[model samples]
Target chain A: MKRNVRSSLGLVVVGFALLTSGMAQAAETYKMDTEGSHAFIQFKIQHLGFSWLLGRFNTFDGEFVLDQKNIENSKVKVTIDVASVDSNHGERDKHLRGKDFFEVEKYPEATFVSTRVEKTGEKTAKITGDFTLKGVTKPVTLDAEYIGGGKDPWGGYRQGFEATTQLKLKDFGIDYNLGPASEVVDIYISVEGIRQ
Target chain B: MFINTETQYGVVSIVLHWLSFLLVAALFGVGLYMVDLTYYDPLYHELPQWHKLFGVVLAVLSLARILWRILSRSPTILAAAGWQVAAARSVHWALYLLLLLLPLTGYLISTAEGSDLSAFGWTLLPGLFELSPALADWAGSLHLWTAWGLIGLATVHALAAFKHHFVDRDSTLIRMVYIKGQ
Candidate 1:
């Protein structure tokens, strides 16, 4: 009985060593499949505090590192072209890209860099990141759900995620008062990436 | 009565003239009214389609009218001094210029998104080309100022017609208003 216990304890220590050394699982770096149009950063805000104004940033590229063995080490980085803001209406989109809103001429890009990722559920995580927009940086939390992952038709691996976050217009230095109800913008992100 | 006779406007010219006037006047009134509309108003969605459809109509008719004016002979200026004749001619050309410009600038504004614009449930025209936002703003400004200018010039044209009818007692206004039975 003592010999059996000693052998079992030795096996447990070896398993722990392999896990701590990260030799059993390797982290994968995935590039967003933006060229295939499988990613979207969609947003909606109240219009004049009366109705919804739907829009999206058309051009963006991003990548993420998924450490399955340790999700805390996972990271994400994304950059968006502010000039590609499309709100369906030409005049409104133009106005959004001008000095009144995004000021794309002055600051043409918005970026996000993840600082921490905490697993909240089997298929969900809370990703905390520094989101910079219009030259203002703030810590934002994204409630993310892993959608799916598998081999692609071309013999490549792919993973997908969906996330949601709410941002205040004033937090990004966008002080243009679009009225009381238009102050907060709800963001929904659906991202699909290819293993690279 | 279907063609010009150098003394009176024919039936076609009279019809086209009144139609153009009515369309332009309606567009001016509607466009002015739309500027004050709130987002929730049903007319906010409905009015622009009708407005743009009628704008297309005006654009087509304006081209046809200009072609007709050139192809057909014009009636003589009646009971007018040389300066009055010059003023009338200048006003006519200015009106033509505005008719063409208002539609073109409006087109520029609509097609800036590089997509097709719909009018009254029909695809009117694929954008000829996409315009930059700055250029689109310039187009909008020109559309507004030229619309105001068109309304002003049209008013002057009408006042001159009334002057010939009421003060000068000439056939100038009657010729445009009436088609000879013939």
Candidate 2:
């Protein structure tokens, strides 16, 4: 009777260990549902020193991994279709895609990859990343907020995030000059991801 | 010589009249040339600044001229037939209306496009309206049309002045050109 009890206790200990390790390794990978998800990337720049000209990129794709237990281990990656810039004018849009601005034919994509994430609050983080635009890479920090994560009605897990950052167009090699017009551009991004 | 009398206009009216004439003529030339410039043209950005600069100046001067017209007296129309006097009066009124409308429409277009008006590096008016492409296009069309109308009317006005001077042998043009009894 004493030997049997000892053996059962040892098995229970091993089972408990396995269960905890499995839980620790369960870092969820969220794939970007490009069709169902909404990803809006908008920008604003000063026009002729009078007011901000608001514009947006109509097409983009991105995904991010969420490790709730290990928050620092979370990662994000995004790719933007540069030619999709729209400022509500066809002629201006064409000029923007020309050599004076994006030169979209030669360099068609802009991308961002996060290097580190630091949690500043329960739901907010400062994500430092390398942003590549016009073939130039520069370090930028996005102030991000994790909106929420949950099981969707369709039996899929989903996560949402919104972030904002600012960059100088001149830094990205976009040196088009309209005197007194602002070179600093404000960028806003909102993304939704699906658990793959 | 600073005021207008029944027979002649003062020095102020003559100066304002000729100054506005020269400005309007120059603006028409610049306006026509700048519209044809493509995005890649070197003057594409530079030319608009100049246009806006001069446009604002013309608007302010035109407004002042209107105010001066109200505050000051005017020389009587040169002795002529009833229809001739009426035609001259109508043309003069149309010219004044065009002077105000051209700048006003241009301002609306520029501001609607979210662009400020500046003159010689000094900001005159900051754009305050949200950008509406439709409104901008409409205002631009109106500005162009009004400018052309002003050009046509001004030509007719100059011809009328010449007719009064050479054909009618009246002091209609001379009164505006020289002080009283020159």
Candidate 3:
């Protein structure tokens, strides 16, 4: 009877350890797939006394670290290469990368690092973070929506999420061709992440 | 006779000059208006298409313009201040080169990214070569820089025109202005 009781106690300890490990493993790290990810940012400005001018940033990449047990502990990191900005014009693109605007030479990569993730509800979150562009960094908040996660055909664990945020160009030190007050620029981020 | 624009500058110059003005004006208006619209919004997405369409048109016009300028006879610089004449010639040539290069680079970049370079709602800008992500990225940057170059040049051109017309009371501005009779 004592032998059976000791064996049962051993099983309980093992079971407890397994459960703890499972809980600990819930802090999942996701690697971003650059080829599969898509990001776009749009901006509007007053044009030569006629109408509003619109432009977009065409290239960006991002990753997510999700903690199911503690959703608020989750984190996100994103990088946007300003040199890839496109508005469908050649002359204009070059101008944007120059000193008057992005000055991509001095500051090449625009990045966003999430400081906090506040879960508003199921599948919805308010992610506040620091966004740096053109050498300027500022606190920004993004509204992130869980687009659902699933298994890929390649047998890799994957999750898809979409986040969006808007900020003024001047916040990032991007001030050029803007008349009077700077225009408000809207940035959109769509991320697809896989386990690293 | 000191020729200002060569054979390559004749018809091509006229076409690029007018089309560039028109497209830039349109783009300026479209860009400004797009601020209020969303990405999925018809106007927002459509504006870039239109911009690309006009870019392709500008590219074609630029090529033809260059060919014509190379083959045809150009008007001579009869009389003008030496600096003014040099500025006009250089700026015009720069504008032409930038106009051609910018659009071609943009098209190649778009093609490299596997993006459909459809102009407006009708014609599709055919991809001439395989897509290269690296080249596309470089081209994107090039496109942006070129735009700034064009804007600066345009500003200089505009200021020069004003200088010629108002400050100097010269015919530089009137040279390109389409007046029925002068």
Q: Which candidate ranks first by lDDT, i.e. highest?
A: 1
Q: Where is the poorest 10-residue window by lDDT in model 2 chain A?
A: A21-30
Ranking by TM-score: 1, 2, 3
lDDT at B9 for candidate 3? 28
Binned by DockQ into CAPRI classes (incorrect, acceptable, medium, high), candidate 2 is incorrect
TM-scores computed on chain B for all candidates? 0.96, 0.92, 0.74
Q: Write the per-residue lDDT of candidate 2 for residues A88-131, one digit (tens) a residue.
A: 75446655776778987778899999999999999999999999
Worst 10 residues of 1 chain A by lDDT: A18-27
Q: Residue A64 lDDT in model 3?
A: 79
Q: Please give, for residues B94-116, the per-residue lDDT of candidate 3 as tens digits.
A: 98888877887778765663445
Alpha-carbon shift of residue B63 in model 1 (angstroms): 1.0
Distance from true location, Cα of A67 in model 3, Å: 0.5
lDDT of 2 at A121: 94
Rank by lDDT, descending?
Answer: 1, 2, 3
Report DockQ per prediction, comma-separated: 0.17, 0.03, 0.05
lDDT of 3 by residue, A113-147 (tens): 99999999989999999989888889999998888
